[model samples]
Target: MDITQLVYFIKIVECDFNLTLAAEKVHITQSALSQVVSNFENGEGILLFTRKNGRLNELTPAGHVLYRYALEIVQKHQEMLKAIKNEANKLVGSVRIGIPPTLLRSYFIPFLPEFISHHKNIGIEIIEQSANELKALLLDNALDIAVLVQPAALNKNQFEEYSIRLGEYAAYMSIHHDLAELDKIDWSDLKGYPVGTFQKSLTSYHIVLKKLKHAFPKAKIQFTSTSWEYLLETTKDSNKIVIMPIMPKKSAKQNYFLQKKFKESLSFDIGLYRPLKSFYNPAEIILHGALIDFFNSGIMK
Candidate 1:
């Protein structure tokens, strides 16, 4: 009936109807939470949850309907409060951002100094994890924004996305490697070579692994790492072919590695992603705009 009850209801559902867990999350006693839900059901004369053997089983049809509306109402309520607070406080809040390890230094960190300089009042917290991990944190509402290498099969409805750059996977090898002379490397060309690439936590790893397996069923994946430096070092002196996003031209030249695109391009878009329903405070809005502008200006190129 009230916003507090609605919040409790949403948390209960999100916790899979576990009253104990929901109570813990909301910092209340289990018996008190149970009594609140019982009172709400009694007052409204509605059976919101189905119970079996004195344990919550699932939401009733009416509960499902209420859950949907509750989410919208709570989000709007929070947004209203944030808007008022931001107006009174004036552009001061922390923004929690997630970036994958592989793209941290190469893609995002270069723009931070300037962004921080411009918004000295805003505090920025950076979380470095793999792309898969970042996605999980975003879904759990732990990250305000994430820099993701947008996969081909991304669920567009879950997040609002702004494409920053378009790129594709490429093969890297020592300059003296046999395939280094070729402008583009075919999947079949790596038949006998040991392969190295990003760890399974990255979307790129799965993309490249699938293509490599399809093209050569017996291909050997000898090394898997989250560190690009490790991959580069592993490939520099050995016969291992590293498949990853195309590195900066300067890095490739200095590292003495040849970059060759895949004959069949494995492409992706690097973008900023935020939960579609989440409210963005002033700090987050400014940070989002700054990131888009930074990428659009082509300073990283």
Candidate 2:
């Protein structure tokens, strides 16, 4: 039954079957409340209250069952209305977000505390995925938003994106490596050393690999890994160079692992992605605002 009928049903029981008292408690006329009870009993094909001299008396077995369920429905309906009212006043909901593992520490870690404090009602669900996987999730609507390295090319017809920041490919090497002393190194300079990088499943890995191979066809890439730790470890001890996105200084404290800027940098367009939409919920609007504020704070600089 609808909420109004459920409420009236509960009120009648609470008023001890007094039609006048129940109707007055519920701000309705006595005859109107009596007719509501009659219509409900007729609709369900069950006698509710026993009649004594044409007056409502004790409840029947069917009436007792309806009373129990009616109480529950009325209570839950009140809660639902309260929740909707709260949502109208403030952001209140959950948002599924996808982020690259590498960017979590650099980008989100610095700003999450303050953002979370400001929007306590908003629940955040974080998913870690590669850039390619994140893009797929956005397209499928499995994720509400994704913080990923922007694709080299985007189809505006399918997706909407905003660039929050930019990154670049850098060669990370051990301090003992001869090239570590250089101010800038070119792709040709990496020929003397083996390179370690992420696997082909990552869009960033694929983009940089294509450029590397185009410049130096004979260049040897000795290692490929999906784990960031494996690539970082390889570059921390030997002359092997790891080609990857430049990590924020706060994220990389290993002085032994030196970073050499690329002479001709392959820039990474990093930003937020969402399915193209004209409207967003209050929670999504707050999340977008947090991201913009974090990026513009110049903490990354």
Candidate 3:
């Protein structure tokens, strides 16, 4: 029988076989409740209760067994519904987000705590990859959302982008390096020094390397790494120069390195991106908003 039928059976058993009291408790007419139980008894071809003076007096042997199973079934069913409702009411789920190593370091790292605090129900899985790799993951449906650097002329059909900020690149070096003393520098000045860049898969690395090579074809390119730890170490070596985006610095670990303004800026746009026409879970939507708010708050300034 269905849950409602089981519930009515349980109510009648608990109400001392008094049809009027059970009907009132379950919000049904006594005659209707009696007919329902009568139909059930007839359908099963078993007497569920004994009758005296045209009133239900006591349960039969079959009635006791039915009552036990019906109570358990109805209670368990109710608990299941309550559990489902609670889950529906809360924003609870896992979200996979991709971000380039540079943005994760300069922009997203500092603001992560506040974002998590606001959405405790959302579990975050941060996938660190190059911007192009992030885009590829989005296309493969391997990532829920990503923060990427968009080229000036973006392909609108590629993905849906929510612009966050515009930024550019500059040279960073150890304070002891002679180039650090220059208020501003040009690409030609980079010819003699060892240049360290992010891996080729990174958008920043591609942008910086193209410009640096075009101007100084003979530049000493010494290192290429995906790890920020290694890149920062390269900068502190007092001889090597690292070219990276001109976003706000979050860690003082890079304090030993000085940033120089470029005579001609190498500009890029940064934003949150998602697969085109893809559906987002509740957690993903909240996180997307948090990323936009974090950018607008000038935390990346």
Candidate 4:
């Protein structure tokens, strides 16, 4: 009946009719959420869910009909509020952005101080996770935008992408390692060495693993980690080769390890991606533009 009830209804459906999960997502107690649903159904004189052994099974026919309208109503209501706030001031709302841990430390951290200084009124929440995890969050509407190491195949229709930088997967080794003497290393050169890279949650892990396996089926990938620093530090003193995207200029200069590009050019685009949505809030719009301008200006290069 009301917007809050409609939101709860939508959340319940999104949680696959699991009331407990829906309640947790909405930050309400299960009993309170059940009361809201009961009140709504009683007031409407209709059953929204089909019950199986006292558990929510699925949406009823009438529930399906209401769901479509509820989604539109809630979306429109949110858009109206965002529009009003945007008109009052273009940079007022909080924008949630997701970034992989590696990229955040090497690339985005440098840009944040400038962005925050310029738009002090706008709030920025950064969610650090793997590229794959960030993609899921972006699609779920939990993130306004994300910086992803763009997959070779992406659902272009589902997302709007802006290229931030192009980088290539490279071998990093300690200066004392034999491979460090080479300006460019071939995949075959890494054959017998102990390899280390990112965890399975990251796109870089899959891409590098595929290449390594194809080049040398017996490739010894000895370490996998979520932290780039950990991966670097773990291999820095050993003969182990860490495969990752080429480090940012500042980091490359400061780090003790040396980088060597692959002979085959294993490359990826670091991009800003957002779900293709009908409405974008003022903060999202401003941040998107600023990001594009910042990257294009060669400031982060």
Candidate 5:
């Protein structure tokens, strides 16, 4: 039987043939409770109660068996809740989350230490996937949270999004490239040159690439391996430029030796997301809070 039916059944047994009293206790109508209990009895192929008055009657032998099991089930459920609350108080759990490699550099590295510090008992597992992949993982319950650009490019109903970073995006060109000689290049320029890019399949990257492709229809494009390290390697020798959102001075830096100039000025949304059910759990709450605080305060000194 469903929890609703079980609850009403338990109350009816406790109230002992007083449908009004049981209904009052459960805050449901007597008819509703009676119909639910009757349905339960019909489905179980047994008489649940004896109808002496027009209300809840006495239990049959089968009814006694069902009541005992129901009470045990209810007590076990209460114990389960108490155990979960105790675990929450201890702050001991593992949170598995997904982050886009495309944006992880800008988002994760700086925030990781603080998250670990704030919730020492919460072990974190990160699955590096494209934003699109992360979305599916979240919907399927394989991931607890995802760091992505925004909810607009995704199925909004599947995710609860919160913007954590608001920053400008820049197109990066090799210093030796001709475009680098210009003070600034407009969207219409760079049509004939190769442009370094991240995975076009990614929602955020695809959104930006759409605009760039519109501006430079003839531009040759190359996708990076979705790491800052590889992005920097492209800058060292390749003439192609990669678009990036420069981190604030406080972000964790890998190597700051390379010079970055503003190529084309643009901006995009950045956010953290999880399934709505995730917020109800304590482990997710702590980890989510840690990530929120990590972004609110700078992660790297």
Candidate 6:
């Protein structure tokens, strides 16, 4: 039945079968209300009400069923309206975000608390995966946004980009290690010790791997873990170096974790990637703004 007829039917029942009162409440003439309900009954092919001697009485069984379904449909329509209004009033929605593992530790994890607290109604899901997997997920509609490292070496058509151009990170060796004695360690310096890093799939890892042949062609690759904790624990005794951005002074309180910038640095752009067409969503805008604000206020950049 049409919305107007459904509303008229509901009003007729709610006003206790008083056609005069129902029509008065809905600001429609009694004849118009009666005619509308008559049209609805004809379209539905069922009698909605029993009229006996100019008095409308109780509904038939079929009428009761239609009324119940009609109530549900009207309620659902109202709910949809409420949801739209709520979305417009405040940024509130679910957004799935994919980020590579290394960034989750050093970037996303540390900044999450503030974002969560501020946007209490907007739910953010963070999927930790490699950059390649994240790109695929974004294209598949499995993810709303992603923070990936560039140059992704993938097709530009797949993702729209928001570059969080935090500066270069250096290949760092331990302070007590022999390479640390030099003000600058070149490609030749990393030759002897075991090479350690997050994962070979990452953008930064590939960059360093490219230069490894120029410096230490014979270097052995060992101790690969996605966890930052593994690097912290292993670096104490193993003297294995990894490439990372210099941690800010606030993190200097962590005794084992020391960082320094180098002349020979690997530049990285922490990127926010999503299907370009989806960026207009309000939830996406709020999240992107939050990330930009978080990094800008901090010393990590």
- Local distance difference test, each candidate: 0.84, 0.81, 0.81, 0.84, 0.70, 0.73
Query: Which segments of model 3 are wrong by more than 4 Å?
Result: 1-91, 152-158, 252-255
Q: Judge candidate 1 at residue 17 and give its lDDT.
A: 94
- Tens digits of per-residue lDDT for model 1 on 1-301? 7888899999999999999999999999999999998998999899899999998889999999999999999999999999997776564889999988767756765678878887777899999988878888888989999998865244789878888998677888988899978988789999989888888877777778888889988666778998887888877767888888876665556556778898888887888898786577888889998989888998767
Cα RMSD, model 2: 12.5
Pairs in steric clash, model 4: none
Q: Which stretches of candidate 5 lie over 4 Å from their true place?
A: 1-91, 152-158, 181-183, 248-264, 298-301
Tens digit of per-residue lDDT, candidate 6, span 41-140: 7876889788889678978888899789889888888899999978765746788999887777667666787778867778788898988898888778
Give lDDT: candidate 5, residue 108.
Answer: 70
lDDT of 2 by residue, 143-192 (tens): 98888876625578867789999877788889889887799998888876
lDDT of 4 by residue, 1-301 (tens): 7898899999999999999999999999999999988887898799999999998899999999999999999999999999987766554789999988767776776788889988877899999988777877877889998998866245789888888888677788888898877889889998878888887777777888888888888665688888778887866678988988777777777467887888899987888888788988888899999998878888765
How well does candidate 1 match the true structure in TM-score terms? 0.64
Candidate 2: the clashing residue pairs are none
